[model samples]
Target: MRIPNLWVNVFIIFVLPNLSNGQQLSTKPLKLTDGQNGVKSIPYRATDQCMPKMDAKRGKTTYGLSFRLHSKGGHCDDGLLICYPGMLNRHADSLGFKVKGLFQIDNKKDNKVNQFCSFKMQKEGISAGQTHWRGIKVYTMPNGTENRQTMLEASVASRPYKLGTNVGQFSIHLGGNGTDLLTMITVNDGKAFIDNQANLQKQFLEQFWNGAFLREHTGLWMLGLDLLPSMKQENVKLFIARNCNCTMETWFTQPTDSSDPKEPELPTAGSNNCSIEFESTSEATTNKNDVSDECFGEKHFEIRFKNIFKKCWMKFANACPNQTELIMLTMSRRNGFENRMGIRQTWMNDSVPGEVIRFLIADAEDGEANDVQQKLEEEQAKHGDLVFLHGFVDIYAHLHLKVYGGFKWQQSFCANANWVLKVDDDALVHLRRLAYWTGKKFRPIVAQNPLVFFGKLYHKYLPIRNPKSKWYASKEMYPKDMYPDFMQGTVYLTTPATINAILLHSGQIDAFYLEDVVYTGILAELANVTLSDQKKHFKWRFDHFDEKNGECEDGVPTPFSIWGAEKLNVFEHQYGRMKSIECKK
Candidate 1:
């Protein structure tokens, strides 16, 4: 059976107290406005400054709180309580707040305490497991009433206590602990609590609603994540998803030198192994040496292989025509869905003649419907490389010429063209370096083994569950190591020869919903197409940006065509700032 929604979120809302400051004594109860989808955020000032009366070694007290309405009415229900402590946002507004530090509520409810979370923040300095607590609990309604009621509380055992304050607009996340005794007291419905702040304690205990109140206000559900400090250096990313709208942000303790450093060890398959295995005495000793060599050898081997392979692939594809070319083969008569915008934008963006461009627009059935035929005619008129075939027969791009389309073109054009860029309409492509990379040469660039990419053992790892996901797979259905360095769908490419080999072997490949990994990771494995390092492949919006330019460090080459942020104003401003330069040839 599937897990319920409320329970899943309970897992994501783990709470941990901040240990940097002395403990607080009479910290004012931050009235959380129920059902507002609010967030609570506070500044963490870590200084040598010590509290006068409290133990100097304990540090200063610092903390923040977030309030929200539970629902229109109230009820006896349970939810998760999460505390995001030790998140450092150097880029916080002049006042102080990091662009990063979003905490999420999982709501999968499979377990009250999760083994691992996508984002975890810890406060430690060069120590093994210093002051870091990543744990969750269950929070239940305080008292029975007609309206919403709040029941939650957290206590610090340290010398002094700290409370979080608001400079701009930020809210801390609070949910349930494992215990039944609720510490937080809810006041009036969210609005009243904000209005009558002076009498919060009285109103919350007296005017709070009961079970019926919560049931009626289904309210918008929200998700959040936080970045914390661990091992002296803080590297954390947080995300918040509310009402299906997701926003992710990242926070780093401090900025590091931007110059490239000597490469670190290559990521290993079992580096994330969470299992505890025991080996026999004699065998264990022998296995230790073997394991060491394999682990060390694998890391070194991967690094060397990547550098050598990247250079070779760049050299191999340098012989194509000097100019750029695009080929489109369409059979649809008319644009049936608004989804066609994906393809239409690409064709219109850079379809100049004498640029090795070609489109083989065709219709298999002679004008089956009005919409389909109209789309076909419109595209055919725009591009001279239009070809219409009656039946489902495979032909080259043009009627007589076998240029190629779909899987076949992977081979046909790649062999002759400098770069064979193929993309789906739903995707946005960044082509600044693609053209440049294609002109260089490399040894046969191949994909790593999908099984190895996923991990040494295929069916052992599990995905962290979330109530929002409709297609959550169980440990049984997806029992493989989450494939690392898998090719993403939407945008990818390789040399002409590689494409030819992939296309020629397409018949033997089975399709997977995640098409990119299936074709490139699985099928490409048969062709020896290993994973390549391309940091710009896929990324989220709030990941981070160049500190100076404010533009994404790895944004698509084109200004106006970059992905993320549908707001017209933001896109236009960013586009204007992204100075256009001719593709480096």
Candidate 2:
């Protein structure tokens, strides 16, 4: 099965309950507004009467909420809590770089999130002097006027957050998984470290450190979102809130009844200026499978990264083990920070002998202007096992460019390796099992047949013309209604000759978006290459064609060379179970 792409991304700016005690960072400076005389503002820490919804139903924890400010009819408007800092730049005790904005989350579904928000603290509660996490007193019957219940008050304690950290839940945050921080501080970027090296989260948090305190620690009511009621539609407003603590002093921005900031447009069609839209979503999990693009219950597609091949700006010299028996080349997402790190720790654990595991991904989808580029740079220097193809981005739309781009790089750099095992970041290659079988079984087969192109092969798969479907292909791209025989990019192994053949014919054909068809099917057919089928050795469960819909489970047998794996946490969670299961005859 093909790896799914998520339309809605998960938030990654949260702190778990009871993990560690976070040190207090700053003190409250000045109040922009006085709520002392009935303005309804107070002081509250993430620890005080806050509800994390940890015990709530599974999938109940949402990360965003918005309501109108001082409007008629007391209705909620589509809004986002923007936690801004005093300045966008802060670090090394000097002025930081980058003009940052408040950490904001944009939730698409309008569900009633039970998460807390800033409101007037009510004295009528069973406890007399109690305030919510936002220092706003709870109201008895209902808080605020009927037309404006979920609203923010002006004070130094309104912690209006921006980015939601859904790392533990869905594994995406700030355009990546929290695991992307490489080496903490790198040898290239000059910066001091705490020496002992805290949770890589500290480095992750430092990305937004200039604009507000990201939730730290495991279980102390790590921040939740607020969902207010709505009356009607109107122009929305935004505020720059701050949370200063060491003593937990949260600050609120003075109310500015201005419309939301215009979202920046992303680059299109050869535009050099790439701007990552601030509204990238996570977790595109629909219940049923979206198999509109499949034919006869099978898929016939792979990525061919076109126009993405530029200069190799970031690379490791001879990182591919010379004359290694197997080379694992993973085509990963640019924002898949945790996936890359998870691969390094799991099956890529050097379990296979004479094999080198290297990840193949570009860093342009999320754009290099922000923290994504910095984290990638650090990860490469620290790991030195990554190959980031420069030039064009490797986005969902650039699938045609990334797959072939990876193979081209391998042909030029790591062509000496015997078997080029191409796989997706979401899939796990049982390195030990692969080695066991290749040496005892298929090694000689590939050694003799240098032009071997093998995997779960498919034939006569038709192109999907559904424009609404994620895998839609245009008639112009591939005029033929049916595709040629090809192997799935999920887990395919190719010899040096096959790689050379595919690259040689790359320039001869017109570029198409669907990668699997272009390279393995079209190009392989053009070069008169071999297409071997190895379906029984792999187990993939793509129940739903959802990117964040991971299928890693317990009690997996060790017989298969590859299993359908997804998500960062599941990879780590099942790594132990995967090792213990013995291959049954």
lDDT of 1 at 54: 32
Q: Using TM-score as the measure, which candidate wins?
A: 2
Q: Give the Cα lDDT of each candidate.
A: 0.28, 0.42
Clashes of 2: 57
Taking the tens digit of each residue's C-alpha lDDT, what string does model 2 give over 1-585? Answer: 311211111112112222224442232222221112122222322321112222122211111222111211111121222321111112211212221123222221221221212211121122212211222211111121121123222112233212111110111011111222111211111122222224423543455434433322211021222111011111111121211100011122111112221211321111111212222112222322332221111111122223222222223323455667777777788778888777887878755556877776654421133466667655655565666554444666556666765676566566788788878887766676666666665677766766777678887788788867766766656667898998776777788778777777666776655677777888888888878776655545433322232222232332444555567787876665555554333
Q: In candidate 1, what are the lDDT values of residues 1-585, reduced to their tens digit? A: 322332232232322222244442332332222112213332222211112123344222222233332222112122323333322222222212322222222222232222111121211111213222223221323121112233322211111111111111122222112121111212322211232222332332333332122112111111112222221222222211111010111111111112211211331111111111321111112222232221110001010111111000000111123344433222222242233433344424544542332333322221133355445444433332233322121222112112223334323232444344443333333333333333331122322222211111122223434424533333333345464234444344444555555545545643323334445554566777555645433332323534244323234242222334333344334333333423323
RMSD per candidate (Å) reads 26.1, 23.3
Error of 1 at 426 (Å): 3.9
Runs in model 2 deviating more than 4 A are 1-314, 366-369, 542-563, 582-585
